[model samples]
Target chain A: DAGITQSPRYKITETGRQVTLMCHQTWSHSYMFWYRQDLGHGLRLIYYSAAADITDKGEVPDGYVVSRSKTENFPLTLESATRSQTSVYFCASFNRESYNSPLHFGNGTRLTVT
Target chain B: QKEVEQDPGPLSVPEGAIVSLNCTYSNSAFQYFMWYRQYSRKGPELLMYTYSSGNKEDGRFTAQVDKSSKYISLFIRDSQPSDSATYLCAMRDSFANAGGTSYGKLTFGQGTILTVHP
Candidate 1:
């Protein structure tokens, strides 16, 4: 009962539509991250939050946006979803205060933007 | 070049065989290393973790970090069919030495897909 969870385990949206993916973690970790995985590119970071109000871009943050208004929730929003954004999105969490902690991830959301 | 590079291997091996996977990084600032195993349509699971330049063995898996050469490796002995999945290598810096910038942020390599056949 104490793990990360993502809503709408599967989703499909039309191109240019606004879509938001939700991530909730019961562990109360201070650090949260979003990553996208494609056919051959593996997992690429989209955005990360160091705390409730501190967020930073990862390697592939151009098409994605994230906000952390609360510690338990970190949501990823695509202002205008495109077909290129149709991929699996994973949410992960870590404890910044714990030195060198491994990330705990959610089951992930399969978003297919047509 | 990617900061961390790993071969996108669809490495196939017979069950009970030993498996070796590796990744190399360009940033020597990395001091912590980790290996994650992910099955199809699932999130990655932390398999092994190592800090500093040495080898740490847990069960049938061994993780080795060679900071001197910026290389990291994972080995699975007597592999099982259930071990088929993607193995990703990730690294982060020791926060105390990151000039207050790094906060357990991980840089990951392109994962290698491994298939253990019966």
Candidate 2:
């Protein structure tokens, strides 16, 4: 498709296990972000990549790791998942070159850490 | 205290009623304001966007941003049953600073869930 795509729309994994969520965008945006949505907290940024091989921590990046090897791909990994990490993960991209452009989001991955 | 605060209302109203949603923020540096709508299991999509301060209207949806009061609002007129969803208010600072620090990040508010019944 022409929009962003997230893999594994739904996932369930045990605590302490490692899991990876994938995000890919066809627009080749310069900025890509990962956010986790939960009740009462809304959407908290986990990690963001400004460009390939450049990433930074966001509001809630303690247990999550992100890497962007290419401009179109930004994957989030939970090295040691916890029950608290059970929430929906969303990936978004933005073309910083344009001030009027808004972030384009994927449907999201529903992850359950049991 | 959070930077952005929203009512998180599970508001119910009859079809054709006027719907008003709002959010308050503590940051004055925020220059771009936005509203996003999310269905039951879908990611949020941008509904309205405004820069700095002022009101922007799009059909039945109107967005108002008042930087002086550090507040923003979204009003839906003649609401429909299909409008049932969660509305989120988000904003962020300028894209970059003098040093060229790109802050393309967004801070979101707790969403307000609304249902319009016929």
Candidate 3:
């Protein structure tokens, strides 16, 4: 119960459709990140938020938008889904104040765009 | 080339066997290294971590980092069937970025899938 959770473990959307994945953490970690895992590219960060209302782009942020309105929630939205967007998306949280805190990840949401 | 590189092996080993996993990185700024175990359909969990260049062991798992060679490894002794899963190597530059952003971000290697058989 004291972990990160992602909604809709699996999702399928048509090309050009909009999709959003929700992420929630119970620990109230200050840093929340969104990563996409593909066949050859391990895990590439899409976006991250240092705190509520503070967000930044990561390695691959194109076509994606993120908002952290609350400390416990960070949501990712795909403006127009493409077939290339089909991959497993993971949400993770880290405690910025804890020097040795390891990132905690939520069960990924598998999204397929066709 | 990618900052981190791993073989992405679907390695198979019999129970009780010794298993080795490795990753090479191009970034010299990385100071903290970590290993994560991910089971099928599950999120990855941190298994071990080491600071700078050194070795750290816990139970049957050992993590080794050689900053000079820009290589890191994970060894599992007496591997069990339950050990079957994908192991990921991750590293980050623990220092603050000059751009005023937190350098707590990690770069991950393509995970190696391992199977321990009975």
Candidate 4:
């Protein structure tokens, strides 16, 4: 029961609507990341947080906002959803204490914007 | 060119056959390499990892990295039906002090899907 979890495993939103995907982990990992997976692109990082209140943009962060008020939670918000935003989103965490620590990922949330 | 490139393959193989998966990267700074296995509708799990250019074997799985050619490979011996899943290759630079923080960010390749039939 101490794994990562994402709410509303599936989501559908109309174009221009605002949507927020929630991610929570019980491991208290210091590094949390958000990535979007599409057909041709494997997994592109949208945003990542090194710790609570410390966030950075990733490869593709446009139109997306992320916040980490607490160490166990990192949520991603789409200000104005577009059809291009329709893809599977994954939340991952890694312990920074070890150099070789592997990233642990949540089940993922499938979002569709029409 | 992308930082990492992999063939998005829906490769099929009979059980007990050997399977090979590979990826190429354009970044020469990447020193840590890894492979992850992802099942349908599930998140990827780390399968193997190697630091620098070398080969590491674990049971039926083997991971090889060639920094000279900027290529990496994963070999599966005696593949089974359970091996039917997507394999992802990921790499990251060893420099962790760019901004005084641990730069553990990873660049991932497009996963390769493999199906081993019984």
DockQ of each: 0.70, 0.76, 0.76, 0.75
TM agreement with the true structure for every prediction: 0.96, 0.97, 0.97, 0.97
User: How displaced is residue B100 in candidate 2, in Å?
Assistant: 4.4
- Model 4, stretches more than 4 Å misplaced? B97-102
- Model 4: lDDT to the true structure: 0.94
In model 4, pairs of residues that clash are: none
Model 1 lDDT tens row, B1-118: 8899999888999999999999999998888899999998889989998998999999999999998999999999999999999999999878887755358678888899999999
User: Candidate 4 residues A22-60, lDDT tens each?
Assistant: 999999999999999887899999999999999999999
Best-to-worst ranking by DockQ = 2, 3, 4, 1
For model 1, residues A29-94, the per-residue Cα lDDT tens digits are 988999998867778889989889889988889878899999999999999999999999999999
Per-residue lDDT of A1-114 in model 3, one digit per residue for the tens? 799999989999999999999999999898999999987888999999989999999999999999999999999999999999999999999987766678899999999999
Candidate 2 interface RMS: 1.2
Residue lDDT tens for model 2, B1-118: 9999999988999999999999999988899999999999898999999999999999999999999999999999999999999999999888764124356788999999999999
Worst 10 residues of 3 chain A by lDDT: A94-103
User: Which ten-residue region of model 1 chain A has the weakest summed lDDT?
Assistant: A93-102
Worst 10 residues of 2 chain B by lDDT: B95-104
Runs with alpha carbons beyond 4 Å of true place in candidate 1 = B99-101
Please list all clashing residue pairs in model 2, or write none if there are none. Answer: none
